[model samples]
Target: MKNLIILSIAGFLLGGCTTGTSITKEGTTNDPKWHKVETILNKDQGTFPNLQSLSEVRQGMTKDQLYSLIGRPHYDDGWRPREWNYLFHFTTPGQGENDITTCQFKVIFDHNMIASSFYWNPINPKNGVCPPNIQHKQIANKRYTLSVDALFTFDKYDIENLNTKGKEDLDSLVRELGKFKELNTIQIVGYTDRLGTQDYNEKLSYNRAQTIKQYLTLKGIPSQIINTIAKGSEDAVKECQGISEKKQLIDCLAPNRRVIVDVDGYIEGTPENNPAIK
Candidate 1:
């Protein structure tokens, strides 16, 4: 179904045809067709409703199975592997249909069989929040996903927990970033262990993130260039054991007590203004 859609659009564009009706996986519809077609397609996931799970969307399937499972591709971009994209609206403008949203998926084929696949519901994703605007980067003559992580601590934590040695190390990092002129955006991720209740943990995480931003500002890093986030105890350490009955939960979740800072932007060459941080 997806491949069909892509083919439909490409043919329409190349031929400069303005057919009163546009053909889509959900069948055919007239101008102002997107909403109606999307509604019909999502009626029950038009292409491959039964093969719902990622596990079920296997890497290899006989042509018969592919047809029965996912209808004919509406669009196939043929990117290295093949790409089939389907568009559907889970929501309509009427009442707040939060449950009714839109989504997309891509299936890549190697030798006409699935090689890799991805499903996305961009309303919200797990990899933290994303900025409003982003432009992808091209690295090594090929496209790549760029990501970074930043670590921040308050003066008190640096003094008591991290000790002077850690503070000195952080100072070096600050200098390195201060001298950095290649990046455009910086993301500061903050974390707080479960030492306290959830509410306190959230506040603590926010404060820690702010502390880093403040430090960066003092170093003349500029506030507008940085974005901050707090993860709290969500990503707790997985390698550690449970804290003793007498111990605190925060201690047990200490592994999650860290932040990730990412800086993105153009380096020396290339097209410029490419988003770096993922």
Candidate 2:
């Protein structure tokens, strides 16, 4: 009995040591499951439950039920413990754009460990019932942040002539904004690259934020619900140095120019006292 216990302890410690091995393209590690997962993610291709199977998933299903219905989940403990996540990717080498979608299903269990309430993303499932009044999952505070290059022209910040890519990005954001009902304040903070003088940058950043507020207000968000701030050249996410060329440097510091719209308040439909509110 003593020798058997010692062998089990040694085996557990050995398993812990293998978890840190760096994933590689060539399957050289002793862990095959970890290697397979890494390969799928790295290459952006993998198998997941089909939409037909996913449609059968319900709000009150147990973890065991979920496993039975969809085989094993793609084991990820990074997010909430009770949340079951799945990523479905369909691709044909010569077919249309790959349809990659993410689905997150979270179950809140009662004292008896049975599922009580639930929520999920991809809200309107093609064949399944919507998870009984889905609510915006909170993370301390809700923030809708985006870089300036992702919303406006290279150096300009006008809503009328927003670039094609920017328009698509904003459309997605607007859809999410429509989901929330308890928006106390929506702050729009603008930043700029460190190319111009501090005074010039400050004014430019402020103008960008104001324009954003106007755009949002035009889209039905109340003007009073919005706040604007100008970060100017401060807090640059990227400091592009060495290259002294005028135009080249500006392109490199694109990430520094950004505008973040933060929505401060609780979302509608979610339980106020839910322990998973973090």
Candidate 3:
């Protein structure tokens, strides 16, 4: 049944003849001939829908499974427990004709958070399919910030000072990095809280960045593609209240002490190739 619907769509496009009638948003009558011509001339510009992926969507599929099938829903109403809406506009190719097609897919979920039913405006060719946005493949760039407290104790910049939790965090990131095809650049930037002299903080931040880079290199990340930078206390993420006591003041400025790792590379497939973060 699915194959037949796909073949029918293919044949209609190959024939260079439009078959579907276009109705207004209000479902009013329209001159089918003129509406078809207009749509053919100027189709809505949107992400291309993956018909094959959509076909996999079925009743009783869990919401997580649905998201894995379809990258992301365009619009979701928080108050609506049963409905998820996805919007798309794209140009359809048939013979040499290019027509704009716009659609809004409404997915209804049952109480168990499983997809129970769905409907699409404009009557999609593959009504039973689950469609994901067509994300073009390109170079991938990812950046993450790790708090200093998580990686090291206050004022500690040495790799030896990295705690067990910090190692675990890096291990998780390393696993994710394996998903990328070719790693281009890995930037490690360090920042510190504004508690010490400018010169001391600057040196501390630079050492911190270098320590992270060194650790990653030891873990098999190519050192040739890695770059380290020191930001010192230039950009504070949080402003601590002026406490006369120095020990308490440092704790309040903790958020500003951190390191940021930015990785740039090429992914094997589309942007959606990476699974959603758990």
Candidate 4:
């Protein structure tokens, strides 16, 4: 409402609030939120769903203990056999009517550690983000690992601050995965900062992921090695039917649009017991 914003708070934390221009003008910058997500996603890697949570999911967790810690997710949204979705709602700040904060979590399990993960907040929609310092990995079985997000920057999105650090972090992450020899198939899913139509968002997410693929290929990664897709607004971080803030329609949608990385590979023959717990 205050200004035009491109938000991606589906993360567990928030990116720093920095000034950025748009693709339109030099001064009309592109908010670095994309960069912020780039850094975070590139490092840990994977699409929205990470694991099948027990019915009672808690703040601190591990897969082995998911059954006891929490029960199972209320719903499991899986597009395919190996992939699934877990939607979670949580809060951070503010009070009274808007006091409660809500979050949606998407996790994928491969034959190894987490295949990918996406965290969202539909209430505020575009206000949560993660910090670069956080470390993530699978806990139990590699495929069905109990992954955890040591997230920071809870209330705001500081993607602009993610910077080159994000790029290098992700580059290193991919290279590390390459070391696993068993690593083979790869999928790149892209989401956008809230703006545009569902159709446009779908294409934009695809293009953005394709652009990432190009960069990865140039870095010794191969095109034949990866598969890519875009869901546009269908896979949005926040699903909104009505305007929460009419004045800031763009801002409202910022966190809803986003990009993700999904992978299908194997490790240790047994394959990670990647299952959709919810």
Candidate 5:
């Protein structure tokens, strides 16, 4: 009778082990049958990856490269696992502003630790595939130029130093950004006139760019999608070589002392049909 009890106990242990979650034969870790929603770190708040970056994801990319593009998986799959899962949110075309489509993306890695296969689930029959609105759409790349004199006082690069006109300009920019439901990237490039030392100019330009980024973030732009670059005294649009007067030189280099913001995002429909372009 004791031997019979031991056999029953062994069967129970084996059954418990089988109930634990694991990757399926198809290499999917987030099977709805066994996967729990609470296991996902992001949960309801999925990532909104740039459309261009999503398009760039191709087969055979390394794990690091994939991480840089879309970010780490939403859930922990295990150590050195072959599958990575992500939850992404996209804005639906012709829908209300609050309406968004959530999709599950899966990436399968080969033995060599390289991404090989990609899959998207919860496909919409009307939309055709998982990632909707990406195909047949064009990214509207717009550039806005803001003069340094209008934005800040001489030799100032802080939000507190932003002039009244600067605030209005940035506010207008925020409104322009609101037109698009999906934003890819916002690049802020800072430039300075050739007056100070090279190191000082570089530092000043960087600080200016950083200030702009901070202002935009405060106005509701995501910090992750904004990038800042400093180009001090480089690519000057106007060169005043013969002007020796300090005021004249500075005035001549006015065009160089400016910040350029490049915004990239997708609009509904093709380039020809996009109303924003027209």
Candidate 6:
């Protein structure tokens, strides 16, 4: 009788485990039971995605569209699968800087290869709710172009060469940066007019970019997130072909001799509510 009771208990436990997997029907990608976090092969690789981009994901979006927006899924799931899964990290509300809430996002596609449903787990009580601090926020890319002529003396590319106007312009830029929430990257690309030798132009442009990066770092921007590129005499905005006069050529190529700063990040509030937009 004791052996029979023990066998009955074991069977009951096995039955419970089997029932758990059968809670949701097979091929139902919208259900959390369809995918398990432990089954993810490349887990936790998805970091903070652009909040606006996450919000833009909608039903009927193709796999390419989804890839273009928030990037590919973290799992090694085959491309032709009916569902794709991703793990995302979101900033925890009222928590320390290092604190984050990791969530799983699943996209289910219909028979025609169109996304039909999306699910997040552990699920929120409200339908279609995302992780914390992931409201449908607006994200904007800010670009600033500063003429090298205005930033430095002729052919000089050092912090000390920054003129009064240059300092003022950069200070204003720092203020504008404060409006952003999570800054992804700040790219500073330097260019010069096509007068100097290739080597000379490359060095000059690189030094100019380095100087701008240094200035931004001194103003409290993190150095690691800033990248500097030197595109000497490449992609020239102005071409001074056939100009015989030196002054006319210089003036015409002034637009090409510039540093372009591109800032990518998300901002709080709508366009109407944000003063930066105004």
Q: Where does candidate 1 have its weakest 10-residue lDDT segment?
A: 140-149
RMSD of 6: 9.4
What TM-score would every model get versus the actual structure?
0.39, 0.46, 0.47, 0.35, 0.57, 0.67
Q: Candidates' lDDT values, in order?
A: 0.43, 0.57, 0.63, 0.38, 0.74, 0.71
Give me candidate 4's TM-score against the actual structure. Answer: 0.35
Best by TM-score: 6
lDDT of 2: 0.57
Q: Clashing pairs in model 5?
A: none
Model 6: runs farther than 4 Å from truth? 1-52, 86-105, 120-132, 198-203, 245-247, 270-278
Better of 1 and 2 by lDDT: 2
Compose the digit string of candidate 3's lDDT tens values, residues 77-119: 3432345556544333231122334555556665556676555
lDDT of 2 at 237: 88
Candidate number of the best lDDT: 5
**Regions of model 3 farther than 4 Å from truth:** 1-137, 270-278
Ranking by TM-score: 6, 5, 3, 2, 1, 4
The digit string of per-residue lDDT tens for model 6 on 199-262 reads: 8998999999999999999998877568899999999998879998998998899999999998
lDDT of 4 by residue, 1-278 (tens): 32323233322123132212122221111232122222322232322222223222332334445434433433322122122222332221242123322333433333332233323323224554321001222222122110001111111113333235445655664665565433334566655544567677667667655655666676766465566777665655555558767546655565644445555432333222332221
Q: How accurate is candidate 1 locally (lDDT)?
A: 0.43
The clash count of every prediction, one per candidate, is 23, 1, 5, 52, 0, 0
List CA RMSD, all candidates: 14.9, 17.6, 15.8, 26.2, 8.7, 9.4
